[model samples]
Target: MKCIMDDLTVYTPSPPAGQNALVVFPQARECPELPPSGYAPLRGSAPLGRVMLRDGRSAWAVTGHALARELLSDPRLSRDRSHPGFLAPEEWSAEVGTHGASPALVADPGDEAPHRPPLPYLTPRRTAALRPHLQRIADRLLTGMERQGPPADLVSAFALPMSALAIGTLLGVPYEDHDFFEGCSGRLLRGRTVREAATARAELERYTGQLLDRKRHEPGDGLLDDLMRQDGQGSLDRARLVTLPGTLLARGHETTADLVALAAFTLLRHPEHLAVLRAGKTPMTAVAEELLRCLATPNGILRVAVEDVEIAGRTIRSGECVVFVTALINRDATVFAEPETLDWDRPAGHHLAFGSGVHECLGRNLVRAQLEIALGSLFTRFPGLRLAVPAEEIRSKPANPTSDGLLELPVAW
Candidate 1:
């Protein structure tokens, strides 16, 4: 199998004439926790090589740190899902592909909107302003946990709901409607079927669209209200004003919530690291950064080549898809000393946990703020917290597109 680039360019490049092809793709039903052993086979091969996906689609996979960053930052690559041959992982490819503009899909009908301005609400000063409120939320959740007693699944009780509430507060979404938004957003992010995903997306849009209109009459101090004002003043378009909030609402909760659960799980597995936090020797910021690097979710970032470009001795033709295996890239041995170990004191270097280039995540500051507050409060409050189940028994939910998160994380103090 081979990837077909734009204009029917079919290049059957050999594996260095004498080298065998590297089977770097993860096998079906393989455990996600166990990193793929593909690197061993690619030792003598190029950093970028062809790998057959689980669905038998062949595309290029970028694993090396240097090459990953180069390709990610390259303008020749495109994030527009409409572009043909843009290989999304099997699970999410269908949903994303259908949502693109070209085919008049209901989810994202018009052309992808021009990039919006950096969220005016997420300024450092604003985040600092919101820090106390965030802490109060964290404290309230922990208090509820204390009242409810132990053996609680942090994913549902703490991580999931807390994340939802934080984003809801920012978007001016009513607290009473969080359950509906959370359910729809979960399916939108991780639904098993395209129909499931599309339905969830539609429901979220309907709800947010209504909320956006409501704010016009009774405005509040939230991003939604701000964007609504811009739209009313004609600075923002209707399509963007309608869709942007939904994107923030879903993504804002999904990724951060997963990080909270995963960070907790990582600390539980590495008691020595947990001790660092428990002893209060290392700053929570440092610990959060280390965990972010180490447990960088195994979600693969997808891109399409917009124009022919030579990278790493290989030509990525316009229209071909590329998968930057960030989890692999973050753990590259050359860039990170002792990359496997969790060291809070390790000097920070560029990591693609949040991605790179012009399309880097917009919510990063908000994410960092939430992580620091959530993790800082959780450990500080419950010094005796430990997993209710054995580490090996913990199961990860399938990557909804690229997010790898826990189904439940049972913990007790």
Candidate 2:
């Protein structure tokens, strides 16, 4: 409720009605790789504490690693944005209301029964099918970066393009139209206002539908064609057909680009495995896994109680919002020895970077494959890779508060 601030006792809402004082969600971040100082004290205090959102609403923050994972699989907690109790931040609540219920980014497949999506698109076997394609893209990007010379922004020249092209190839979207969807993803991911996000969402929807129409006339090998087959079988309707690829396009690429950049940034900072990477001593698969564990986004995921539930001697009322802190879960000292240190040999399975439960990321396999290829080719080709600017000069704050991405990752090879 109330956080200690150097001898000052500030009360949120005055606590006059006998309700607990609310803790504002954040304060300052002393380290770019870590959470804010204000948040530091809350998790240590209890597994579930009251967190006040902007605009005066409050939610419970799940602080413990075991509890966070348990609750993620608890059917009582729902991520359905359409739910009135869904604790979307005040800024974008209206934007969510503008869209109807579907298996879009707002909810998973079978959240609506009629929209159950085909399962094989991202299965491990199909993901393996994309490996060679991913390698080619990585090689081409590296060659281009080399020609452009040292001191390049990895986010723009490699990470961003690799993601865009990979998702494009998978979805059968034309390579020439990457700029269009990429602009939409930018607004939707980092737009300062709800209007910008809503406009971009609508435009992307229109474009996806038009592209599918074109695909029908000139059939190609895209996962969308799989959806088209389902459409012919009365399994997928037009709206579900359009929403899925748009969801994949927007949801798949940007955070992954940010993540790949973060992985490269972290490796350069530690450099413990720099020589190993260049010499091909450790497998790239292992290196990528460690980077994933060390650099996954440290943020809370929001879910709302669909019904009353009791846990840890507390009753969470229906419609109440719950947040599971991912950082605390992934970096628990008891579970992970020297939790902050990266060890390529350590087994880091079941990590929550892609989240967990029924809503676990559909792109997990694609991302893992992409990371292995991208990070492998990146450091191997440029053995002299290092940050162009000092690490401290790179500010950690993301362009959007909802994300933990660096705006630009400047580096040299």
Candidate 1 structure quality by residue, lDDT tens digits, 164-223: 677767677776786786677666655656677777778877888888778878898777
Q: Which runs of model 1 end up more than 4 angstroms from their true locations? A: 1-34, 37-46, 88-121, 175-180, 187-200
lDDT of 2 by residue, 270-303 (tens): 6766767767777877777666666656345778
The whole-model lDDT of each prediction reads: 0.68, 0.68
TM-score of each: 0.82, 0.82
Question: Against the hidden true structure, what lDDT does model 2 obtain?
Answer: 0.68
Candidate 2: deviation at residue 167, Å?
Answer: 1.8
Residue 15 accuracy (lDDT) in model 2? 38
- Give candidate 2's total backbone clashes: 0
**What C-alpha root-mean-square deviation, in Å, does candidate 1 show against the real structure?**
7.3
Candidate 2 residue 75 Cα shift, in angstroms, is 1.5
